[model samples]
Target: MTKSTIKVAALSAAIVTALAGCNSDSGSNNVTERPTIAECKTYEPTQPVIVKGDNQDLNFQTITIGATGDMHGRIFAYDYALDDVDVNAGFTKISTLLHEERAQNDNFLMIDLGDTFQGNSAELFNPLPIHPVVETMNHMEYDVWVPGNHEFDFDRDFLFRNLEGFNGAVISSNIIWHENAVDCKNTGQETPFLRGYQIFDYNGAKVAVIGLTPSHVSSWNASNPDNFRNLDFKEEFESLENTVDEVIAQYQPDVVIGALHHGRSETHGVVGVNEIASKMADKFDVIFMGHEHARFIEQIDLGAAFENGMDDITVSGDKANQVEDKAKSGTYNWRNRDSKVKVIEPGNWGWALAKAEIDLFKDQDGNWKIYDTTLSNRTVADVEEDAALQSEMQHVHDKSVEVANEVIGKIVGNFTNTSNGGADEAVLEEQVLNSEGQRLYTTIHSAKVSDMPLTDLINQIQIMYVEEKGSEAIKEQIKVDVSAAALFSDASNLFNGDTYRRKDSANLYMYDNQLVAVNITGENLKAYMEWSYRYFNTYQYGDITVSFDPEVASFNYDIFDGDIEYVVDLSQEAGNRIEITSISGSDFDKTATYVLAINDYRFGSTMLVEGWVTEEDKIWDSSNETIYAIRDMLTEYVGLNDLYRTEFENVNWYIKQYGPSDAKGNVADEDKGEILQLREDGGEGQDLWERLQNKEICVMRSGPGARDSINVSVNVDNNNTWFVNPNASNPYEGCTYSNQPK
Candidate 1:
């Protein structure tokens, strides 16, 4: 057979085990006859009578086992309680796999690696007091069920009441009862309910299966401290090893298996299944590990032992892979050979089912031993639907589908493309021109502008900032640059793309406006007249530069010269850290005011920009809202063709010519200047005020009797100010200088 054909054949053989048995039709019809405790204990297998002629004979013994994981029952299909068909289909598939295996082998055991309660709407939304998941698992009739960490999501009372109704054995070796507490009758703490080991006798062969759960229950469950208050979780490996030793010494079982909740790696390691397989290889003949959701079938050797006059090998393996290493030489060893013990994990949410077949043979000493084992997946797609289970889960499935189909919102435009072109001409440039004739290259994209409201944006920014940098870091950065004047200073011009290229979206540059300040002295004002000549010398931006005379005062600033006349000495100015000493009277306040021009990002008061709250004379609240409104207005006005336009008017060209010069006539290149003019509705300085005004602005007051002067304060007992005015007609206005004290 071809490799593909061989693989298909092996998979088919793994799911179904055919064992030859006598025609005991007498007990076949006794479905309702529950065997007594003594009768069930004494049940023994009868050897099949072989019809042999000459030297020909036919007899075979096989047992099939099925495993699965993560059945968070009682939970709705999803968070919204939609998509119940998928959930029902999953349960149906598991049920079908179970019955199929049982049909192939009379003695078949089905185990579930847990996580069967408390998730989604079913658990959260249901009006009924009892957990529906408990009823479903009980109906499935799992032979053995292990408790997962999430099983305790519900309080202990609910767990006890529901588990009491389950027909299967609920096992956990790590949970220890408290010395002073009275046993809860319905819980695993009750007698006979809590079993360290269960011995199953199949055809005169005894197989002992030990159960263990992770000791770190508190780490996963918040309610664990309350629910399992009377119980102590012991070390997993230590508890399992001790239990296995005791069981082996007492029962001398032919095979040992462990149902373990702990994975092999550190508490939080990747590929936890492999780690568990490696560490516990020497402990058990076969181990079924959970906690980590991974699928594999491999064998690891534990050691060699003499059983039934034959050298029996104890191998560690999973149901996904069939070969494992043996630790006969003190260290775990593995060979590329067929495996005996198979571990399997059917991933979360009943997405898949795992099946294994173990062949048992008797040795010369009449002791049974595992001869061989194989594992395979019976895809959920292949299993026929169980009508009863489907009927029960139909309502949930329909609800889930309905919720998934509804649309949340619409995308009116495409996302932004940030790729840089190879050639200069290949670059796309767009500019914005202020009414004063100042021009700035402004590229408006969807990432730069979106449909989300400005208020929502501000809320997100504030929440994100607080989450990333502690409240203290935010406070410090604000205190350092309140006016945000230094925010555009030379020190802030440092840019490192490599260090900033983080995968997180929060770390990316999100400002929508840029500020540019001009400081000209009377001595250099004449030289600065030639700024237009120097500006046009640089590479052409989106539009070609034009020359004009400097006849208009678009902005207000001081004209300083080497002569001290009219040159206000700002050396003693407390908050004049931006180096511009003689600011407009309207720009200064005895209350320590600031003028802030920012983009939608800054106006939203995103923690990404420091000092938004602490260091501004005045902020424009129209930041994010203005952008959204502009987009909407532009969409209507331009119909999405080109929502914005810019022209290099006369004043912009005149100012660009002189550029920025030093004392030695060393001219600074405008093109190389880190500061770039961002073109939005508000000009650089005015934009900050607009953003602040658009936001929920607040005015803060500090000092002993000054408390009532300000409208609102961000934090009490501090000089920090907040512009909590969301309805300001113009968020940014002239700063009012105050000399009066309360």
Candidate 2:
């Protein structure tokens, strides 16, 4: 074994010996004494030994810790998937900052909080003896390493190789090798997959860093078992506290840092970082977290109850509004709390570096204790990229960029013209203006308002995949009558003149989610559609834009295609919005069963959660077959069919009642010249009118919670609702009130 591998093995062995209660074998001359659970249970914190003539007055030392997480393969200052230059983030920028921080601080340590080995072009180099990202981390001399859930996205062997290659200690307190699992590490016996925690010596003081990965990886990757094959994750709270207790009992470090790969909020059974940090506040001093891809530095008051209940304690970066009774009452000062723990998360893709400068002082007894800590998230906006590091990884960067830009296929038609007389082939893409009048050229804006070729392409590919590669039962019995896919990104688009590239495919389907076909009744299907249509706000008089419910994510708004016709009437409330007219050229049946194609995330999180479907209802899955992920499947489809023929007729759904309709069920000529004139006068409702002409919805781009009070209330005059803008003192500020209209 190499030096790094040997170091990891030795360290891991010692950790396993201490935690697993492993006894000395018959071959051993002496009985090796290891800390038992009973002994650990009775253990107390260790006391320090004082040296004579050690002056307590001048015994202060400041330790600086710099951390980054969710790097996601951003080794260079570029997005390999988009083939776009990223000026904001990259490992080189982080390296420059780290180097600068190291020069300024007497005691400095670098840490990476994990999710390092996957995403972008990182996977392309996985087959290498040492992955470039891991090699880069090794070069940077990372002191403590935590493995996030995404670390298991690839094969177990690949993960192990990279971990073994990493020079730093791989510490994950919550993971253990399964009893029946084959030893992928090639060790003679089964042991903990990684060391629980690593203790670092800063000058004379010791700092213990405990690493925690999310426990919900198995649930997230239920469709793909091979990702985390031999590993089992323990409950975060129980495992973390136990490890902390053990660390304190064995070696009472001056400082304790939680390097967590979990978020602050409790989501989908994954324990929140705050829950552990709060309940175990006496031991922990500082915590660094990741996996939510957010950035923030907040001092959490320990053992304090949240004013709005447990679920209300959220610290989502950029959008956090944490309210606590203690905070409001002025009893929850960060430094004055019973135990103050500062939590910091550096935003994903190397956007910022989370720093904690902790000052410690030696007491009369020579016991080192924390005096104070300063936390900040330093942005990489103005930092110069490390040219040396970038130079070293240039070959990999070039290859990734080349792969991203490699043309797979071509699109011949714009797919916009359903009627033949229009310039379909000549039109590449029409530049449209948003409500703000900013010129935008994209497929997403139009796709969201009505059925478009982009989503239709996704739906068609899924249906074709099911028909071609599904199981015998699925193919013979249930036909894929309908398929649904979300317009995953606002950047996803297809231009008539442009060729399909790898980036194009990736942009179209941004996730690694597997395709799943579930059986559902027409009632459940309609219910699902209604739930999706709830993303839009209800229409009201003098309403300018089709706003979104801030609570709803756009990705959850699935659009259906294939042998189906439906209308989303924004005038109606959510539950009554979806009106499915027909399926398979027949009247919609509420009780009749039909197979629906959807991504695994939606199936697991929504379909299963809502009790609308079960595992038994699943007829086919891309994971069970040899089909690629939806993104790769898109590329494969493009490769097979070099030229896309946009005989695009799958405009199966549309919105209604948002604008006037004629006797022929089309947008009627406005007899109400006041409304037309009001729209023509510009501002507020002008863009909505322009969009109405194209059968599109004008989306409101206000930040979340900004539109909460924007609604329609029933008017007493004619049972018609008027617009209510929360920000406007006069509700109908710019527009004419309906009492004098028409």
Best by lDDT: 2
Q: For model 2, how many clashes?
A: 0
Off by over 4 Å in 2: 1-58, 179-192, 268-270, 274-282, 305-337, 415-444, 471-478, 523-542, 549-554, 569-577, 587-590, 605-611, 624-627, 643-648, 657-684, 687-742
Best by TM-score: 2
* lDDT tens per residue, model 1, 1-742: 1111112123223322221121112112222423222211211111111111221121335666677766655222232322223432266667766667777777676677776664333332222333456555656666667777666644566666555545566676656664444543344432222557677667666666677666655433321246555555666666666777788788877666777765545333222334444445554555666655444444443332212111223233222222323342122212212132345554445545666666676666666666655556454533466677656655554443442332322222211222221111112232222221112111111111111111122222332222223223334332111111111100011111211110111112211122211122222322222221221112222211111112211111112211111111112222221222233322323244322222322222222122223223222232123222111221222222221111100010112212332322223454222112321224532343333333333333221110012222122223233334333563222111111122
Q: Which stretches of candidate 1 lie over 4 Å from their true place?
A: 1-60, 74-89, 125-130, 180-193, 268-283, 303-342, 382-384, 398-742
TM-score for predicted model 2 compared with the true structure: 0.74
**Model 2 whole-model lDDT (C-alpha atoms):** 0.64
TM-score of each: 0.44, 0.74
On the 0 to 100 scale, the lDDT of residue 611 in model 2 is 69
